[model samples]
Target chain A: MTGPKPLSNLMEQFQKLPGIGRKTAERLAFHILKADIKDVARFAESLRDVKEKVSLCSVCGSLTELDPCAICSDPERNKGVICVVEEPHDVFAVERIGEFTGVYHVLMGVLSPLDGVGPEELRIGELVARVEKGGVDEVIVATNPNVEGEATGMYIAKILGGKNTLVTRIARGLPMGGDLEYADEVTLSKAIIGRLKM
Target chain B: MPLYESPAVVLRSMKLGDTDKIITFFTLYYGKLKAVAKGTTKPKSRFAGRVEPFVYCNMIAFGKEKADLLRLNSCDIIEPFGLVRGDFEKLKHAFVSAELVDICQKERDTNMEGFELLLAMWRRLSVEGDARKQDLLLRLFELKYMSTIGFHPFLKSCVDCGGDIIGPKAGFNAIKGGVVCHKCITSDPAASRVFVGSVKLMGKSLEMPFEKLDRLKADPGLQGDIDKIVAGFVKYHIRRNMRSERFLAL
Candidate 1:
């Protein structure tokens, strides 16, 4: 009550955003106060726009301004092949590659038992239903290369293993410019295991 | 101490900042400790796979004599136990192991027994990696951990009366530290009556070596009993519920 209510309120609002802890929120609130009225209005408008415009695609669970999302609705995208990824941001990475022509199924999360995330918490049931509808031939699990991500990929593989769907994981190996000498053993091993004929 | 090295298994890790992680480890020599992994969340991090839970890594950390946390300088993988990371069931049991070790281990104690038990479990899991065997291995580990921590249940006789307790007349009193005979049930009002088979199996399970767990003729019914009995004992002794147990509730 003693402090400026609007300034303190702005700090608390910034704290609600991801990665903005108390200290960072304080900095952000001060920065916003120091900025011109026009820039602050644009920032606030963008925040409101995100909440109003973005909704998850019912079929693939990817966040989008439109239902079914842009990728899911594309006729050029291969409907029979689906890339299962952990979050909506992962879709952006795959899109940036511009190599794959398949549609995606965003899992929204990986299986992280330590953090209490399990199969039920993800959008896996929707993925299975999509598979059961019968045309899907392959589900490419593009989960992160970390432990939880690998575990989630394996779990989804098991669920779809016997359902006539070909389950495959995204390859793990050296990056395009990664030095062999500096590479970790696991990555090197995976690179060896996933080697393709030259 | 100065720059030191030890083989460590990451217990669990949580985000420190947008680009860093605070990782807890159960080390080979230093027992349990936590360390900050700067820029670990970055795409080109050198510490990527080595800091994940259940990875046994040779780490060069900035350890101090009185500090609770060591700043991890660099780590090279010793044994990734990659199968455990890739397999769902194996991953679950591995998480349970890490959780138990993190909860049960004390910092700077440097006890080798706990470290050895966990190392053995991860080694076995990496090789065979069967779902059924993973279950057995975890139950065996719970009993082993209890014994190692001196919470080994009193199986041969009643905890209160020193009478030979077996069959339906036996009841486990967690607060009393073991089984109470039918007549001695008044000693601990919180004693939960369990099947004599479960009590006998817990005692028998303690005798079974880690490798021999897979060969044990365990049926679904007995496995269920072992699950219930062991969970009861662990929860009661730890005096708080563990988050990993519910995730592993197959």
Candidate 2:
């Protein structure tokens, strides 16, 4: 049997990345193949550096070269209102809106029983313990507006049900099944404002 | 060990460790459940193609109580939602619909009605054409889902005063939950006033069924009026604006 060409192998690898399909992967692979050596080297090095240097923030799960993410360390952010999301990418999504003046806790994933993801598989217990220790007044369930996301938010709400902290779900203005990263500034801003206590 | 069976729709499936596969399904009796279909990834496995996304199946699984995963015993495909996979727009609409059910319904709690609503919409998407009609159908589904979950926006009469003063031309109070009469809006200390045209649009939306909604249309000017009313009220109450809706406008 003949092995795939180097270009074909590169396209296959690129396809493994989320949101990249076979056609898009081929385009991306060709683009990389045509790029200058320096540009390609920069791209490759950045990927390596991200793995080698980036670590999860001690307080939140956001990736950072520092122990605490920039937001976690900043004194200006409202530490009292923690905006909890499911993944590190969501941290960026919330930041782009520019409305929330709070820190975050990335659960790493929502509860997906089919994939064997449960509370222990996520950063949920740590979040609860963080709230239990006090000072935090609100926990915003900003998980992706999808099934696993809602369940994860609900489970968090139930676990933190009686705690002194107020629990709320991020308003669903972002569309029923859409990803948070795609929401416009106006909608994201309004969702933050319209968040109702759960 | 606890054993149970439920009517489920496969939302997604993927290979697991060697010879096994992990399948995620939304069920009628148990909400959402995951099972390890051991050896199902192999070429000779019985579960091949039967457990993939959009297949409506009756599943039987058993495992220790409180454990996250169950052992798969059987999966019988009742409906594949096959018609949707053939068309691009239909597939997109189906994915969005499945995603809605996946995100909205609670886990471990049976939302049989929601499960049905989702399946019905999937069936409709498979056969329906017009893009505008598809959008409205999804909106109707959203409204129904929101209502089932108890977030139903009050459409008829004042939510605060309980008066029969429905907005004939248009009027609404997003803050007050639904439509408020002109008198109540002007007098109430807490009410937020909204356009009368917007209120009428919302009234029509909440009152109409999904299949029939596609047939109902207004003049271009009136259509804009209706869209704004339904959208504003939805945005105010649901609290999150959808990106697809924004895409639709563009």
**Candidate that would win on lDDT:** 1
Question: What share of the reference contacts survives in each candidate?
Answer: 0.65, 0.00
Tens digit of per-residue lDDT, candidate 1, span B1-250: 6775788888888878677888898888888878888888776678776788888898878867787777889988888887777667788898888888788888866867778788888888887656776787787788788788778878777888898775564577777667777777766678877666667767776776666656665667667766766778888888877777776753
- State each model's CA lDDT, in order: 0.81, 0.71
Best by DockQ: 1
Q: After TM-score superposition, what is the CA distance of residue A55 in candidate 1 from its true location, in Å?
A: 2.0
**What's the DockQ for every one of the candidates?**
0.54, 0.02
TM-scores, all candidates, are 0.88, 0.48
lDDT of 1: 0.81
Error of 1 at A122 (Å): 1.1
Residue B83, candidate 2: Cα error in Å is: 1.7
Runs in model 1 deviating more than 4 A are A1-36, B1-4, B63-68, B166-169, B181-201, B204-217
Residue A118's C-alpha lDDT in candidate 1?
78
Model 1 chain A: worst 10 consecutive residues (lDDT sum) = A110-119
Q: Interface RMSD of the predictions, in order shown?
A: 1.8, 18.0
Per-residue lDDT, model 1, residue B45, is: 78
Worst 10 residues of 1 chain B by lDDT: B210-219
